[model samples]
Target: MANLLIIDTATESCSVALKYDDQVYTRSEIAPRMHGELVLPMVEAVLAEAGIKLTQLDAIAYGQGPGAFTGIRICISVVQGLAFGADLPVIGISSLQALAQGLYQDKKQARVLAAIDARMGEVYWGQYEVDANGLMKLLDQERVCSPEFVTISDPDTSIVYSAVGTGWSTYAKVLSETLNVPTVIHDKPLYPFAEYMIPMAEYLYISGESYAAELAVPVYLRDDVAKKAKDL
Candidate 1:
């Protein structure tokens, strides 16, 4: 197993997690507008708690986002600097998918509708299903759209689906009615947590998907044109 460092500042919260010796260490705070100051400290604290240097880790995983623009920038800058200093590989995980993976771990459910409140009357949305391997896989295109514009194509009524994140909280009735199912409201994973990125990074690492420090990037699903994941 690869020792990994994870960083997420793609929203109001700032968090860091370190996976070493098959154990995970994490720290986070709901510190909006403080990502620039809090992210590095959280990273330092996790590394100290794990009693390891940055260079000892196998890779650095980051929350590549469709979130607060400044928050995403902070995370990417930190990850690139750390990866460059440690000469380690870099991997990016989607903020929306992170919420689903976190829900899968916390709720132990297979179906998830993860959304984030994208300002200017829109939301960053994605649906995820846990396969037999217990990994959350995106079911369709992730996109930036108004709540009314979101749709689920031929969803299975046989399975119970759960909704999470600020977007759901903001427009619960709209999403619940749109998905057309009995939905559970969860608030624990309103922000993407770095710890949840470990499984994904490990998966990508084994699949030989690592990148250079300069190549570490964010997934800003939003653009002048309303774009879909498949369109990217």
Candidate 2:
């Protein structure tokens, strides 16, 4: 396994994880609007626990999001700064995918409907199924849409999908009605975590997908909505 450092502040969660010498160290908390204050210290804590320096990492990975605009920005900017200082390559993992991965880790759920309450009556959503390698793979493009319009492109009635994220909690009735399929709702992991991001980041790093610090960027599914919020 590569020595990797992972960070996420893409939802209400602020998390950091460091993988070194086959052991993982992590720190996480659901502290909304406090990510900026919490993330760096969390990073320092994890690195200290792992007894490693930033420059010792093979690469740094961050939650590149379809989440709260401010949270996503905080994650990306912090990652860029850290990667630049360490002269390390960076990887961007989707927050939705991380949610699905967390469900898989927690329950071994292979199929997941990951959603984040995007506010404005919509959700940031994606469908994921575990690959043979056990990493969650996106079934279609991640999207920002109303609860009523959300769907499963290839619905299998025989399969019991797992539902996760704050979106399900916020619009449970509407989303459950719209999906119209059997689902087991996971209430514990409503937000993404950096520890779950390790496998995906390791996969990407091995695949030669890591990039320079300057190339790291956030993925806001609703660009127009983000812009409007920024303007206001």
lDDT of 1 by residue, 81-189 (tens): 9999999999999998889999998879778889999978889999898988788999878998989888764677876788889999898888787678777889878
TM-score of each: 0.94, 0.96
- Candidate 2 positional error at 151, Å: 1.1
Among these predictions, the greatest TM-score belongs to: 2
Q: Which portions of model 2 show Cα errors greater than 4 Å?
A: 225-232
Model 2 per-residue lDDT tens digits across residues 87-117? 9999999999999999999989999999999
> Number of backbone collisions per candidate, in order?
0, 0
